[model samples]
Target chain A: MIIARVTGTVVATAKEPKLEGMKMLLLQPTDASGQTAKGSPVVAIDAVGAGLHDLVLYAAGSSARQTEITKDKPVDAVVMAIVDLIENQGGISYRKG
Target chain B: MIIARVTGTVVATAKEPKLEGMKMLLLQPTDASGQTAKGSPVVAIDAVGAGLHDLVLYAAGSSARQTEITKDKPVDAVVMAIVDLIENQGGISYRKG
Candidate 1:
């Protein structure tokens, strides 16, 4: 799993039928340094209810389909959990507002 | 999706019940350069029949569970397809033997 920040939502009108009710969000991968990682932002299926700026835990690969919302779907990434707090290296680095 | 080379197999006798009978393999992520990318090797469940040294296309996140072999399983990654040829950066970079 990777720590990411929800940046925005993705609006797609025409998609696979299985993805009709799934929420999609734009995510920026975050490293331990709390800086955005080197990569273009990824669009992920939102399994958990997370708002913009929320720190989330996301899974990639077949593991992503393990969620209730994504089961048997074509989603490549999914936000599984909304992070409450994070301790990086040694000290507490992030906490939900 | 990412292109990866199967490096080896993983044996886990004790694991989640959902993971029983799944073939797990070690994967080294490859970039467009055909070089191993920076990151620790990942253990992925093999949905397609892939052998050692085989270049395969793998999907991460909930999409991984979309395969017949990984449906509802706890696998995080899964090998989905074998690569026949790769045209990267406007050049034919790799061709399977």
Candidate 2:
């Protein structure tokens, strides 16, 4: 899972039905500090209740399909968890309330 | 899971026989000594045994359909797990063996 920030949402009317209720958000893969680390923007399937500016953990590939909502969909990068904290070897690198 | 490399390979004849023996390379999502931190090439779906340059661990949406060859198909990113080491705190930034 990579940390990211939700910038906005996308609506594709022609997408597969399995992707209907799912939220597609524009994400900037970030570090623990919630800053862009890769790519200008990416489309992600949101799950972590990620608001417009919330830090989130997004899962990709088949794992994104693990949810009951995205079964067999052509979706990638689903917000699996909201990053409440990140403690690598660096002390208290990030935290969320 | 992040860290992988497999510089070439992709064959698409017709379509969807569940990706038709599914060997789509030209994928270059790498890290941990293989270079390219963010982008340049992002067509993963290889596994741990990835040849032509190892170091891999890729997984994206729908869990890549949690496959015995992507059961539900429509794979996002496969190649899960292949990092030998990744120590932080600015000590041993990355490693593979």
Number of the predicted model whose DockQ against the real structure is largest: 1
Residue A90 in candidate 2 has what lDDT? Answer: 32
Q: What does candidate 1's lDDT look like per residue over B1-97, in tens digits?
A: 5667788999999999888888999998775334555456888888668889887656675676777778778877877665556543245556677
Off by over 4 Å in 1: A1-97
For residues A45-73, write the lDDT of model 2, one tens digit per residue.
76546678766655575666655566678
Best by lDDT: 1
Report the TM-score measured on chain A for model 2: 0.84
DockQ of 1: 0.11
The candidates' DockQ values read: 0.11, 0.09
Tens-digit lDDT string for candidate 2 (B58-97): 7666566676775565456677666666666667755766
Q: What level of docking quality does candidate 1 show?
A: incorrect
